[model samples]
Target: MPFTPFHMGAGLAAKAAIDRHFSVLTFGIAQIAMDIEPLIGMIRDADVLHGPTHTYIGALAIGFAVILVSPFICRPILRRYNYEARAMRASWLACPEHLSKGAVALGAFIGTLSHVLLDSLMHADVRPFWPVSNSNPLLGLVSVDAVYQLCFWLGAASAIAWLVGKYRHGRENG
Candidate 1:
């Protein structure tokens, strides 16, 4: 699923459930990070689409990298979005510039790990535990159609939940 929006569904659900403890921006960055290897392979017509980058070791490395750099990358974007949200009176969409390092790390890890997990189910070439063994035990754990449906429904449900929570909070404050 190169460049697929389906990878974002888990991140959306996590952000909705863990708001302050989940950085959607960091999660998104990790998702992109995970796919970079695959994208490179596709462009070069390499035999290995899912390489070492799809492994848990790779995820840890990518997650740590995101944690180190996400604040600098996300702060400005979040500030701009917050400014626009404020101008539009859409407080629910507003974001803060200061995100906890722990939260960013958590989100990044979740994003990378989930990407590996989901892709492992559909992609026979993904060896999530690469260094341990080349075999992908998780391949075909679920149908590709089921994976798509799950991702879509999870994203929809989480978005609705987040909106409702934001609306309720606004009402209470008002």
Candidate 2:
């Protein structure tokens, strides 16, 4: 699932449910951060496609990195998007000008850990508990088709829910 939109589906669902507690931009950054090692491995044609970076230990490290950098990255992005939304008179869709440190950390941790968990189910090379054991107990936990369907359905359901919530809220406020 490296470089795939499947991961974003989970992120979207999370954002829909916890928009105030989680920064979607930070979550997205963590997702990209998690995949960078695998992308490099794919380009280098390394024997292990999903190497140490796909492990829980590696995810913790990556999550820390995301927390450190996400403020810098997410702030500018949110500022610009918020500016555009304000200009367009769509404030409800805008993000905060400054994200809290807690939100960044939470999003990063959730994003990276979820990425590892999901990949571990599909990719036999993903040893999520590595450094303790190379055995991938999560491999084949679910079929690839089921994984895709889960991601897609979760995303669809979340999107619908978010939209409905926003619509109802808007009607009440307006």
Q: Using lDDT as the measure, which candidate wins?
A: 1
Per-residue lDDT of model 2, residues 35-112, tens digit only: 898889989998888888899999999999999999998877988997998799876666667888888888899889
Q: Which ten residues in a row have the lowest lDDT in candidate 1?
A: 88-97
Compared with the true structure, all predictions reach lDDT values of 0.88, 0.86
The residue-by-residue lDDT of candidate 1 on 1-174, one tens digit each, is 778999889998998999888998999999898899999999999998999889999889988888888888899999999899889988766666899977898889999999999999899889999899999998887899999999999998998888788778777875
What TM-score against the true fold does each predicted structure earn? Answer: 0.96, 0.92
Q: How accurate is candidate 1 locally (lDDT)?
A: 0.88
